[model samples]
Target: MTKEENLEKMRHSTSHVMAEAVQSLFTGVRFGIGPAIEDGFYYDFELARPLTPEDLPAIENKIREIVDADYPFIREEVDKEEARQLFADQPYKLELIDEFPDNRVTIYKQGSFADLCRGPHVASTSEIKAFKLTHIAGAYWRGDERSPMLQRIYGVAFDSEAELEGYLARQAEAMKRDHRKLGKELDIFSIHEEIGPGLVCWHPRGALIRQIIEDFWKAEHIKRGYDIVYTPHIAKLALWKTSGHWDFYRDYLYSPIEVEGQEYILRPMNCLGHILIYNSQLRSYRDLPLRYAELGTVYRYERTGVLHGMARVRGFTQDDAHIFCRPDQIEAEVAGVLKLAQLMMSTFGFNDYELLLSTRPERYVGSIQMWDEATDSLATVLEKLELPYDLDPGEGVFYGPKIDIKLRDALGHAWQGPTIQVDFNLPERFDVCYIGDDGAEHPVVMIHRTVLGSMERFVACLTEHYGGVFPVWLSPLQVVIIPIADRHVDYAQQIKNELEEEAIRSRVDERAERMSWKIREAQLQKIPYMLIVGDKEVESSNVSLRLRSGEDVGMRSLLQVKSLIKAVIEARAQTALEGESI
Candidate 1:
């Protein structure tokens, strides 16, 4: 067996042991599905009371006992009726058993515990070498909102203690770098329960950072010949039906609202609007490759259980664009998007990333020939650029095939960043066309893309990637002036004003706090620069410059400091914060 298969089997076996432990601990615990995930394993159970962190230790102890016993895992295949009899007391199991179409069913047993599962477990309970019960979460029985909610215990298992410890260390770092924690600490963004979950409210600092990013994004798109456009949030439901979204993507869409007898719903994507704009007028071949871009907000019905901080939200603004071009322009357009995605990633300090070429799904709308051509175009571009990518078969959007850019952050966690898709179906559905050289209207090839994916998620990524210490250009508050005493407050304010004039963001901390305390607070906020003004510096007409990285550049003239900061911001340099660089 391959190493991956062995690891999966071991983890699966560890989950079974955990289930056995839970069964022993609780009076009557009814289990839902338990499966091995990418990094670990999780088991869902319906218990009398919710499980807590304090209960994990007891469960772990029970698991240790089972492991020490070294009971062999025995596999049993029996008729459906026999399986029902075996798990008559477990309602969830009975429900699953009823769903099985065949009479033969697989069950595994170790010692006194048994579960309805297919075999592939370790030889014995003792094979689980290293494991840890990480945390607990609430999960629906089958991800249905109206279904019964169950408690899910998550854990990680490895072949060695060293591997387990390494994973735990990374988990700890991930907790520290979690965007939710850092966002709150840095006063950037927050989601309030009163405002409803998954909706972000950006504070001044966060809004400023978004403004900077959007400004930079607009400039880049203009340079690449993309026309910025705006579209409404809600559109007539029939429009989506025409675009094939209502039928294929209904699960993610919200129900339509009647406005004066007309049904309208929140737009789940920005592509259809762009397509409509393309069909708005007759176009010649000279206007081929018309790229329309929008930082448009769309709403989707993401289940509450899957709602995460910025990562999976109900509403987000996609840095979305659509290109209408002739068939021959597909390669060049795809290549341009790749280049833009690469530039965006590199500018944000993402040096490691993977590409994925996704093909058509079974329920896709386009013809087979069109699907193959679209998939081939994306593959050809990746190969022409000599870019390595994995094939994600049947993972493409219903409209077309795509190339996905998954960027790796500082902790080597991959985040979805960019996507370039070739679409031939949407233009057909909307009858988007341009006049050809033969003086006949022909179907236009459509390309959909996003360089940064979404502003909310990208900012979340930026916060975690930088550990909240954003580079000079991206930092919302580029500098803070800390006055030593009341006498120096005026000098600090003057410095802030001067920096602001240079288009550098700065604030004067005139609060009634000690200078050292203020500096520490500024450092905590991750401001790029902290300028200290004191009686000595008031005499000398200069200030002490300190970087958020904890490096101190000795007293320097305000002119010198402003010049360095302006130059850094102008160039959008990522590594100038460590005093030595200056």
Candidate 2:
């Protein structure tokens, strides 16, 4: 078996053993679904009482004891009636059996436990070499809020001790770099119960960083022949119906709002608005490939339990753009978008990334011919650019085929960054057309793309990727001036003024705190540079610079420092002034 398959088997089997251990310890326990997750496995249980961490050790011991017995996993296929009779005492299992359409059912029995499951388990419990029970939580059955909440036990397993150790080390580092903790510590953003869950309120510093990012994004799009546009946050619900969003994507959409007796929707996507703009006027072939860009804010209904800090929020601003082009222009437009995505990701210091081409899913719009044509266009562009990519079958959106780019961060964890989708269904649904060379109206192909995905999630990723130590170009406050005493406050202000005149974002720490304390605070804030204007530096008309890394560069003239900072900003360097060439 492949390594991934083996790992899945090990994890699944470990979860079975854990369930058996839980049943052995707790009386009147009922089993729920248990499956292997990304790096681990979790099983849900309905017990008479809640579990505590103190109970984990005892349960772990029971699991080890069962593993020592090395009982073989025996699979049995029985009729639906027989399965239901066997699991009559287990209500959850009976419910699952009732849902099955066929008469045949599969069950696996090992040691003193039996579960209704599809079997691909390891040969025996002894195959689980290394395992650790991580934590416990309460999860709703089938992820539905109305269902009963079951106690969930999470654990991790690996084929070897060395693999387990490596995974644990990475987990520790990930905890230290957790974005939610860093976001609060750095005062970047916050979510309050009063404001409703999954809604972010960006603080002053966070807003400043977002403004800088948006400014850079707009400038780049303008330079690349995209016209910036703005659209409202709500529109008539009929517009969504026409775009096929209401029918296919209603789960993520909020309830309709009534205005003047008509139903309106909070915009869940920006593509429909961009398409409306294109349809505003009749177009010729010459006007084809019109690219419209917007940093549009959208709202979606996400379950509260799944809502994370900023990474998974209910409301966010998408760096969204759409292109309406003729059939022949499709390939070139896709190629151009690929180049733009590469440029944007590399600028953020994400050099290692993977591209995936997702094809049509089972429930999709448009004809098979159109789907094949659109899929071929995307494939042709990837080949033209000589970019390596993997095909994700049956993973595309209902409306189109897409190319998804996932960027690997410093911790080697991948985050979704960019996407390019060729949509034929929307054009057909809206009857979007342009005049062809033959003096006939023909449907125009549409492409939806995003570079940064969303501002909130991107900032979250950036915060964790750099551990809140942003580079000079992206830092909300580029420099902080520290005055040694009250006498030197005037000199510090003078330096701040000079830096501000050069359009640099600088702050003067004129608080009553000591100079050392101020320096430490600035360092903790992760400002790129701390400029100290003591008497000695004031006499020589210079400022002593200290980097966030604690590197001291002594006594540089104001002009020299300003020039260095400006050079770095202009080049969009990802590092500060360490004498490295831009």
Candidate 3:
């Protein structure tokens, strides 16, 4: 067999080995479809007993034992009736058999297990090695949530041990940077079961950071000629119908609420609202490139089981905007949006990003020429910016072609952000228009773009990216004044007041604990500076700086300390808070 055929057979055979091993270990574990994914394969099963983390090792051992026995994977093609009889006890396999052609069906037999499958498996089970079952989760049969919840045993098969180890190590590192753990540790945000899932309640510390980010975002948008706008959280259902969101995208949207018999749907997107604002006025050639921005909060329907901490949520605020530009300005507007996304993300210490440009999908509504033009425009912008990107064929939304940017965190996990999408359907449906210099009304080209994705998800990503070690500018408490003794309380308060007057977020820790304990608490809170003011500092009119890392930076004036912090904050510098870089 050719190398391509051999690799396919290898992965296919590994699935059988995994299934055989599971069946041997658990007497009544019914099988489901097991297919090879991009990096690995997974099998679904309906277990008589729910398997926990403890059951993994034994199942793995059984799989290895099966491989060691070197069972030959014999393939046979039989008529549909024979296949059905062979898999009589397995309903899921029998379902496949019923769907198969009446002419013939293939089955693979290994050891005591014979499964109804389409063959091209490896010759023997001994060829299966360098594989692992990475995770176990509950999945709905055939991805329909109403169907039976089956046990999904996810595993990875690699060509070598080194590759397997590398994948495992990356997963371990991702766990270390898991945002839920870091969010609590850093006191960023939380979702209480009592308050319900998919909703975030930001604590004071977290809200302060978000405000800082929003302030920066607003200032940048202003500088880039974007008009800030606000709209109602709930809009008339008639508006959604006009935008076509009610028809095509309503499944992912929240149900409408009736107020006095008028259906009002919670806005799932800011695009339609912004389009309404654009259509509120007749546009001329001079107003061809109007940009509107808003930190718009939106609601979408996400099932309870799929809701994650911050990353996936039912209600979230998006850093959303819409660009109403002429067809001739499409390329420049796309490039401008791309530049803005990079600038904002990089300030938050996200420098590496992967760009994906998705072209028209099979069921797209726009004409082929329009799709080609929009895609070519985006490609031109990418090329002009000298950015490397991948083309995702037939992945664009039904409305238009688009660009997606995925940012890499410190742990090397990619999070989706900064999407730019061209929309022909919305403008056509809304009948948005702009008049040219020649006095002819034309269809406006609307581009929907988002930077930082959503506030909740962005905060989660930032928490994990920095590992909770936020920069001085983003840190909730930039400075904490820790008095060595009760006698120094006056001096600490004085310094705190001075720092506060300078707009520095400084606080005085007045707890009756010992000096060492106060310092430790400040460090634990990840405060950037622990200003230790005591007799020496009072006498010298200077404060001894206990850097967050516990290093004594000798003595510096209160002014000098403020200057150091201001420099770091202004630069938005990212460094180990405890180390030489600070």
Candidate 4:
């Protein structure tokens, strides 16, 4: 077998050993499916009680014993009746057996522990090595909420111990770069039980960063011929019903609010509002490709288990836009949006990304012909742009086929960055039409897109990508003035006033602390530059510069320093003092 194939079998076999250990330790522990997933393995069980981290070491010890025994994994085929009797006590396994229509069933046995499974495991328990159980979490059986919640044990196994060590080291770095930890330490954003889970309250620093992003997004959209628009957060429920969101996305929709005997709901999307605007006026082919953009906030009822910091939130603003164009203009409109997406993503220092062309799903609203045409248009744009992409079958939404781009950061983490979808269903459903030169009404093609996705998720990606050391343009406090002593306070304040007039975010460290302490505090805050003012520097009309990385940049005139900082900010450079030794 190839190396990857062997590793897969080893991981699978390790999961069986884990199951055997669990069965011996816990009496009446019903088992669920255990599968080798990407980078690791997981097994679900309805145990007598909750499993904890403290329980993992004991399980690992039992697994070691099983491995030391060198038990061969034996595959056996049995009659359906025999399989039923074998797993009669294990209802989860029996449920699997009942789903198969065949007369025979296959089972894999390692030592005395037999499980109903299809065979593709290592030869024996001894073949498994370099395995460690990581952590535990609750999972619903088959991912159905109505089903019983099961305790899931997760573990990692590699072909060698060295590989395992490397993976764990990378995981440690990932933990250090975790957005939730940095968000708290930097006072970026916070979630409270009173405000509910999956909802974020942006602090001053985070909001300032968000404002900078918003300003850039709006400016770019306007430059691309998009007219900014706004829509209410809550609308009458009947509107969603007409847009097909009520029938299709009801699960993610919140409960209705009754205002004066009318049912209203928090909008889960901004498409319907844009559609309403398109229908408000009589359009013409001459107005083809009318682009409307909005930084609209919407709400979704996300499960509590899935919420993490700003990455996944209940209320977030999407940098959403819709294009109403004729069928002939589809390619040009898509190309324009894709170009804009590329610019926005690259400006944020994301150069590594993957594109996916997602085709129609099983349950869809548009006719197959329209779906084919829309898919072809997106593919044609990709070809024209000389961009390669992978095909994801049956993953598109019920309304359209989309191009999804995932951005990879320096840490090799992928973030959902940009997307463009061609929708024919909404236009047809809403009867959104434009009068053509033939003097007749025809359905206008609708394009939905977001270059940077939601504000919350984008900020989370930025936080992790740079490890909270944001670029000069995106930094909340660009420069901090640190006065050496009480005598330098006035001069420092004057410098701060000058920088503020230059539109550079600056602050004065007025605390009665040592200059070193103040400079250390600024560095801890990840401020881009620390300007030190003392008697000598004040007398010379200069400031000592210190980088957050703790480099002394020597003393320089405030005029020259401000010019360098302003140039970096204006160019949206990825790093401050680009090409400088510091």
Predicted structure with the largest lDDT when compared to the true one: 4
Q: Write the per-residue lDDT of candidate 1 for residues 402-449, one digit (tens) a residue.
A: 999986554556778899988877888888999999999999998989
Task: Give the RMSD in angstroms, all C-alphas superposed, for model 3.
Answer: 4.2
For all predicted structures, in order, the TM-scores are 0.86, 0.85, 0.85, 0.91
User: Across residues 120-167, which tens digit of lDDT does each residue of candidate 3 receive?
Assistant: 788788888688887899988889978899998888887779988998
Model 4 lDDT vs. the true structure? Answer: 0.90
Regions more than 4 Å wrong, model 4:
72-91, 94-109, 116-120, 159-162, 407-416, 579-582
Ordered list by lDDT, greatest first? 4, 2, 1, 3
Candidate 4 lDDT by residue in tens digits, 53-87: 99999999999999999999999999889998999
* lDDT (Cα, tens digit) per residue for candidate 2, span 6-49: 89988998899999999899899999988987777999999999
- For candidate 2, the TM-score is 0.85
TM-score ranking, high to low: 4, 1, 2, 3
Please give the lDDT score for candidate 1.
0.88
Better of 2 and 4 by lDDT: 4
Model 2's alpha-carbon lDDT is: 0.89
